[model samples]
Target: MMNWRSAPLAPATASQTASSEHADERIKLSDEQVAAAQIKLAPVETTQLAEHFLATGTIVPDADRIGRVAVRVLGTVTELRKRVGDPVEKDAVVAVLESRELSEVKSEFLAARLTNDLQQTLAARYKMLWESRSYPENEYLKSRLTAQDARIRLDSARQKLLALGLNEAEIEELPNLPIEELRKQSLRSPIKGRIAERRVDLGALVGREGQESELFVIVNLDTVWIDLAISPTDLSKVAENASINVTAGPDGPNGVAKIIFVSPLIDKDTRSAKVTASLDNAESKWRPGMFVTAEIPVPGRGAVLAVPKAAVQTIEGAPTLFVREGQEFVARKVQLGHEDDNQQEIVAGVNAGEVIAVSNTFTLKAELGKSEAEH
Candidate 1:
């Protein structure tokens, strides 16, 4: 440290002084770099990486399998134990009908049976006499014809009872029980389902077989139908066995449905075709008339790079994107694929995990336009 300041002054040439001044200028520029040349970066969120499609539809019951149980005979409802949404077993009594016509049919069937039995006994006697030559052949033949006519009458009467909704078992059991007691016929559920509608109240009169009166409508809710209306252009995308996602409420149970049928005809007014999807509704959460939104996934064109819809921009009718390169963003033209509601498919010009300007993409675009003009 001996005379260090005096030794530095001894070599104070012009070149040395200019070198010091250059160093001071460089330090000053470094201090002002942030304010003079800083780039305004736009913060953005990353896009989701997955495959999905969106569709809107409504929920409905399978009408083909659903049935309405009605009274075969016109009568007052003597008993109605079931209500809407009540699960009913097949052949379970849902209501009771007091019908005088049912009693008359049962009485006719009994009389026909008595006549058939008497004719059978007389025919047997005639057959024995003819075999022993005690009766003429024509007389025996006539007696046999009479027996056939009686049997025909019996069959006719049995058919009438069947047409009246009486099963064979009930017809056979009729003679064993009092006919008057069977006047109040219990209407059983024709199918295993939940009661969807009830039109007849207690003591209300219902129509008979010839009349048109819907007493109760039961629907098998174990399997439901999702009616999705697809636009004519998208109709070809929907195929048999296409996978669908069914949602009930905003945040309710979700179920998978399969495209069962696509209507061959397009709706004249809506210009859309009905695409039917079958879903399992054993939980009973999906009602017949409830509206639902369905997401039907059409076949994708293989996996490709994609980004958020917001990250993309349009330049001269071409889709453009801002790709981050080092500390700067570069404008690039990209080929796009099918676009959904939120995201679009990037077919080319970008790779996975590459940062893209999503928010304030227009600002990046403006910078790109300026750079292009300057060049």
Candidate 2:
């Protein structure tokens, strides 16, 4: 709340006298009084005034930030490291499974590795003997070819292990692990996020026919999407990369979201285009399924003469603005045009580069009313 102080109307200036037609509507006050009344002034300028339409939307997790934790091999859930709502990091192991299918692959890799090692040793010895003429050239050649074949098999087996989700470090450690642990494999998250859903329990059989393939679903809520349905009439006004203001509800999270997607096809039943906006939610104040309202801005005519919405006051039911002329302020009736939340287009009665009272125009209106009463 602001305290309003009344000031005596000063003598009219030459410009005010020139505009004698509006002399009665002018209110005068000293610089000290203007400062005390908290009346701020700004230059009227040319800017775009966009029209807006409201659309209902819902908050949801960003699809690109979602992660699924699953395994490729047939396995039994032996351990669950995370539950619903637990935070997880990228590549973090969230669970472990025991799979005979995985054990068979590991065994093949180990056998190929051992055979390649033995063949390489034998090939090297045959080379040395051949160099000294102690071994036959044909025998040395046979040994060398066998080693080459063994190397190719070893590479193939290693690739199979990689396809089954074993990392380089895990495959290297396979030969050192005891035989009993050969069947164990870990499930890791592909993204840093929180566990949104846990579909498996300990001892549950997964990765089989008619069984759940995903063990957990993780979502990063640092950013979220507000899905909106735009009517066909306003779809032309909306475009990708534009911004919309969104409010979850009364007393709920509110933010300006960037339009990321605008569907080309409209729904047959609703006749509305699906639009989506990306909003930063680092605070995590918003959640999925929360209903929100979005204010989409319709493209406006290029730059036009405009003033701040605050500068326009309703005097006796008509929109008015106080233009600062010389040392006094004069109430000028103006014609209004397209307007958005902050700016109102002035189709008439105002010109660019003229300084006018912008904030606290109500005080000037009060002073004008008082002057009228005095007259």
Candidate 3:
């Protein structure tokens, strides 16, 4: 009877005892046993330590290098010679305008030239008379002054025409041409570049008072820009003239870039500093507003002691890792630096070529937690 009914087992007490025993068994391994278990742990691959900085950016045209072509006078666009994306040379004719003002300017220049010729003949005659003592010095001087005034008027008229894109020789020859042909003015491209924009179509009246319309926009696509917005915290890591890598497509056709400028002011809303990098676009494959990824290499303090990021663990906000000594893994604290998405830099508490648990760190952590609970 004593053996069969030994304090009729309580189901709750029995269950509790079983759980405690299981927990005790989990932490029952001696130090020597733990050392043996750790020997079975796999070694993590070692990597050379280096500094890395992450940033996102986009491709844009260098605005300072862009050029614009606009109509100089109010006129109807008689001809639209260039379309968007057409390559143009310096001083090439991009469009033609027919304007009444241009015709008037040509006429004024012709009349001034004729008056100047007549005055020149009179002044020459006065000079001969004065030299021969047939005219007073003052009279000859006055005549000469009148002739000089007329010549000045002619020069002013010629310059006005030239300011309107008319050559001086062209203005002098305009009166010989038909009136209908003289009225048309050709607008030329000022720079060698491709047409990036076209605002006016054929027959569009541009250059009206108070109307600042842009007839065309030209961009020199031989060089491009990489606009990177870097956080203020990382601004110190960048340097002007530093080299960077630029990837164009999704998979990336990689190219090299040089840091051109870094803005001193931070964006009010985003608090990020703007950095610009220049790239050669000689092939014209990169276009404005194209999305791109840029990688800027930040110099590190040469080689340093480090470990794989996965090997590091956080125990109550303290960064820790398992140091495999002999057959045992003891938890050790470490100071970290420059942690990228893949790997972390260990400034202290570890050395190169040392084996650490990387893949199954969570399992080790769980084992530690269970041991603590049992205690």
Candidate 4:
């Protein structure tokens, strides 16, 4: 560390010497001394300083990212492939159900398929005989019509299987499955997530009237929502798409998030409006129901003279900043107006285009304290 000492200056005039003895707020440091002391300077410029409002919120899973595995047909849960908190992929089979209703549909499809094949064979034979004049045209027409009706029935059966949650591939492969497995249907997750809730146990009957049809609740924690409660007084400062910083306890920073929603109506009991923000949780660091603090930037009044946060120092209970006047640095008491995380608005005691010490102002404060002690 470089040692900090007051730099010497040339002799002052009579009035200057008398003024220096009166207040003695100035500390003179040479160019090399300033550089060695690591003192940096910045111009007091006009900037839009956004004041922030504090609000509390809880982390929750994004509503759109949550998925549910539910059954449509009456069935008994035969197997569960995933338990609560288990990770799952999109379209992953999470559970299996055995249902007599599904078996009947599968059987109907098989019957229709067999009849269609038989009718098609007979229709081909009848067409050959009709072309050879061995069979009447009317008989051949009836045979072809029967083949068409069989095809229609097969299509209807296929549709029924689809409505019962069978995909095209599954329905196409139905004939190859054994008889015992015919009643079994696999339930797949609609999204890639972790299972949040499991509502059914093995052998539990689902899809019955007045019974729970849902099997598992899966949530994608890649992104989450922070529901904030904004009071009525600070509601005007909040706007959609505004950015904010979120922190969960003392576990470092959770990064920035954008405001996605703000409610127009305030809650009567809480006397606050609801605001929502979306935070990226791809690391799985944040979870639902975790309490977090959010810092929201309030709208700035306009551009005003401002200085870096480091430039301001507290001396004798007054906010002080060191302003460069010619070759000397003078401490001036400043009246602060509004401030954000980076800047503090200088409402008085400073002007635009004025140079001030922006870094290591505490060194200047120490020197000022030392000078007063000498007197």
- In order of appearance, the predictions have TM-scores of 0.69, 0.77, 0.67, 0.80
Q: Residues 303-353, candidate 4, lDDT per residue (tens digit)?
A: 988999999999999999998877678888999987888999888998889
Error of 1 at 361 (Å): 15
- What TM-score does candidate 1 reach? 0.69
lDDT of 4: 0.88
State the lDDT of candidate 3 residue by residue for 125-162, as single tens digits: 99999999999999989989999999999999888888
Q: Judged by TM-score relative to the true structure, which candidate is superior, 1 or 3? A: 1
RMSD (CA, angstroms), candidate 4: 4.1
lDDT, model 2, position 51: 79
Please give the range of 10 consecutive residues that has the lowest summed lDDT in model 3: 4-13
Segments in model 2 whose C-alpha atoms lie over 4 Å from true places: 1-43, 48-54, 131-134, 236-245, 295-301, 313-333, 353-375
Instruction: Please report the candidate that would top lDDT against the real structure.
Output: 2
| Candidate 1 overall lDDT versus native | 0.73
lDDT of each: 0.73, 0.89, 0.74, 0.88
Q: Which prediction has more favorable lDDT, 2 or 3?
A: 2
Ranking by TM-score: 4, 2, 1, 3
Better of 2 and 4 by lDDT: 2
Q: Which ranges in model 3 have alpha carbons more than 4 Å from their true place?
A: 1-50, 167-176, 209-212, 299-346, 349-375
